[model samples]
Target: MSLKITDECINCDVCEPECPNGAISQGPDIYVIDPNMCTECVGHYDTPQCMEVCPVDCIITGVEESREVLEERYRIISGQKVA
Candidate 1:
């Protein structure tokens, strides 16, 4: 599943730089995670860096997706041939 920044986000600007896939960005009111680019850090790290660094714990899993789906997204995002 992809992660999402909730309204509880304090806009502390901590999560943006932490996203390995460059999925997180500043929205009109809060930080938003691009689901198309979000792979839950599957290809980049053991865990989602943004969630780890968010002080307010506002980052939460959004759309429900399987690990295989996330891995495919990671491959596509990283320019790897998807199997």
Candidate 2:
């Protein structure tokens, strides 16, 4: 599942730089995570960096997806051909 920034986000500006896939961005009100680019750090790290650094714990999991799907996304984002 892709992570989402909820309204509880304080806009602390920490999560943006922490996202390895550059999926998180400043939205009109709070930070928003691009589902297309979000792999939850599947291929990059053991855990989502943005969620790790978010002080307010506003980042929440989005639509349910299997680990295989997330892994495929990570590979595509990393420019690796799916095997």
For candidate 1, lDDT tens digit of each residue in 39-81? 9899889988998999999999988788899999999999999
TM-scores of the models, in the given order? 0.95, 0.95
Worst 10 residues of 2 by lDDT: 1-10
Q: Candidate 2's residue-wise lDDT over 1-83, tens digit each? A: 47888899999999999888999899999999999999988988998899899998999998877889999998999999998
Q: Model 1 lDDT vs. the true structure?
A: 0.90
Flag clash pairs in model 1.
none
Q: Model 1, clash count?
A: 0
- Candidate 1: 10-residue stretch with minimal lDDT: 1-10
